[model samples]
Target: MLVKLGPLDAGRVADLRPYLDLVPDPRARRGRWYSLTAVLLICACAAVWGARSLDELAEWAERAPDTLLTAVGVRRHPLRWRRAPSRTTIGRVLGAVDGDALDREVGAYLADLHDASARAVSGQRRVIAVDGKALRGSARLTAARRHLCAVTHHRAVTLAQAEVGAKTNETAHFQPLLEPLDLDGALVTFDALHSVQANVAWLVETKKAHYISVIKANQPTAHRQLAALPWRDIAVQHTTASTGHDRRESRSIKTCGTADELGGIAFPYACLAIRVHRRRRQSVRRESRETV
Candidate 1:
């Protein structure tokens, strides 16, 4: 149950409840009294209200008022009693349901929600962020922590995700994580660790996508070449300054089109290079400056 945690978005619930019905029911109808959709909705509500575990979920359902249980479609007892499904029942249903089918249904719902916003605007590519995160609540069950690489929309709606091998880092799992997404002409952004030729090449040549990645010491040559650009000769194109909480911060940036002056940086599809200088100041004239 990959639920979005926050104050429950009533609109989101309404939009997604119908999609939940598409998840196939694993139980036979003759003996099954509980609706699978209702169970998922109850779990969704539990997550929204900050329940973190099975015990907590059961406790929440037991404590919930009759109105709340009924609102999420919990079945009424035949004698007109208020009732909710037990944690054991929730666990069995979720454990038995086809996870892939559930993900597909949810993905379809998300795509509908994203259609208006994720569309390309005047040929400008929409952004998708790729990153890995440690799965919460997995440590108790495994010797190694489970980590996942996810492709998400700019609004943080997860489009596709896959578990990375415990022995491997996110780099090796990048292609698989992104291949399922519709990335043509989209701009994908990732961190320095994923800035490699193979990734950029596949995105550009195979997927017809654009990418933005950080150049750090991990890619020594590109970092050195980009770092050696004639940044001092270029004027700052943008600048911003703000002061708050007894601290002051300022940043200025310079960008220049790549050309022969950069000595033809040996990087694929080299384009513009940018430099940003930042300064932070605390009390009593203490200051720190860094450039990247």
Candidate 2:
């Protein structure tokens, strides 16, 4: 027989309980065997168990009494219990739960996990990939849509998440989500959509984080200015390599004798840019290049 444990056994679920206990609810009325702590545990466990609706949670509470009791750390023998929390009870508790506080706890857990994992690696820094995900059906109002902005450190799970209101643009909320994270000695990476100069500046200056943001047409002026400059003529030298059959190889190099004209990009103070390019070609017994 497979013995079952509770959501506390889950890695993410274990991280949430301690903080959930600290949340205060004044109008909470406890049942004979159930307490506020148990209620939160139920909710957290339900969330971990993929309980998206209140009826599902209530049904779990009724049918999985043993599992629920064990999860709540109940010592007494299971009673012939009925009248598990109604769906209304579940909804009320959810409404009372502090979303911001829960978000902070989840963020803290991720930060701790990141720190622990980083200690095992060789580098002195970490890389955080910034991305956004829309919660399906989370947008309740016809006019507002809910989106979650998340940061995931490379080679690890999610590091932090924040829910934005329907009307708030995600780019405007990106900084605040980034503000509490430990970005020192870290490299933050984002896509062209988040390549705002102000955002990049904040990552470097405010968070002390290095950034690598892709440039695209949204910033037409910046793109034009970058392309117009003579980067190929600068002292900044880059090497690219190509390989083929019979141990054949080719490499191209470039240099700017002076630093003034390369890219002509106005980076924030104390910031620098390096451009790299590479090409590779290989075949079993021979190699060929088709050039126009």
Candidate 3:
């Protein structure tokens, strides 16, 4: 099922006031022409509308109607006819704002939204995905390239993010991205890069949550052990099949029993060693009995 989020209303914009209010204004009061809240609201709205730079945000604000400005808490200017801030002012203010504080506030706001939505649709499991991405336009030869993020699977909302430094990778920053979240009853997922003993321990033991991580060749011992499991002998196996575009595919997944043959680097509370196999066939075959 797909849930479509509607357009943002005045009430929803007002909900962000408390969080944006926490961002300190670094500008001097004497020459301050616009309210900090108004500028932030404008930037946030512009960002939602796909504005990636300060100039684009300023252009969006310039073209915005008075109703949008007023709805976002922009008050009348004392001397000027317009209440919107210039692109330069927006850039300066944002540059001077504390990044860590802004991240926490935004993360908290998204978490609140997630919790409220989850309550509205009770009994459904929430899946949060952790991954890393590079800033497309901000790449530099000497600087680190990627930023780690924790996002929800369904709504694609980013709950938290941390920059991956030059010397460190996504693995080092994974735990910090998840530290502020309330993960109770949520199933977190990560790729093989994060499929380590520490992350599994934290998810299952410390947070009391469930997880599904890829077991890849990077973890040689775990991958080898899981691959050697007797999947055919397993009592319960799940199978799924699909056919489309002149091709047919089927997959079967099974879990191993609780035997100590795996090894000493055991995952905390680990009960299942899963293996999946996939087979595919095409509708058209060569005359020599070779399937393509």
Please provide, for model 1 over 1-292, each residue's C-alpha lDDT reduced to its tens digit, 9 standing for 90 to 100: 2455254455666777898898989898887767898787777778778888888887787787787667667778889987788889888887898886777677667655555455545554577888988777767654666787877766677776677886788999888767756677778888887888888889888888888777888888988888888888888899999999899999999987777665766566767787879999997779999987
**Window of ten residues with lowest summed lDDT in model 3:** 283-292
What stretches of model 2 exceed 4 Å from their correct place?
1-15, 26-37, 62-88, 154-158, 165-167, 218-221, 229-264, 269-292
What is residue 165's positional error in candidate 3, in angstroms? 0.9
Best by the TM-score measure: 3
Best by lDDT: 1
- Candidate 2 per-residue C-alpha lDDT over 1-292 given as tens digits, one digit per residue, 9 for 90 to 100: 0011234454444565675566665453644344555666666566656666788777776665665566564445456443455677667767876777666765666677677778787775787899888867766656445788888776546667787775666788789888878888788888777888888888888888888765667878756655565665666355445445545454444432224544345544323443443333455745554210
Each candidate's TM vs. the true structure?
Answer: 0.75, 0.65, 0.81
Runs with alpha carbons beyond 4 Å of true place in candidate 3: 1-6, 78-82, 217-221, 240-250, 257-265, 279-292
lDDT on C-alpha atoms for all candidate structures: 0.77, 0.63, 0.74
Model 3 lDDT tens row, 187-279: 888888898888788887777789877777787876766666655567647878888877788777776664565542345555666666677
Better of 1 and 2 by TM-score: 1
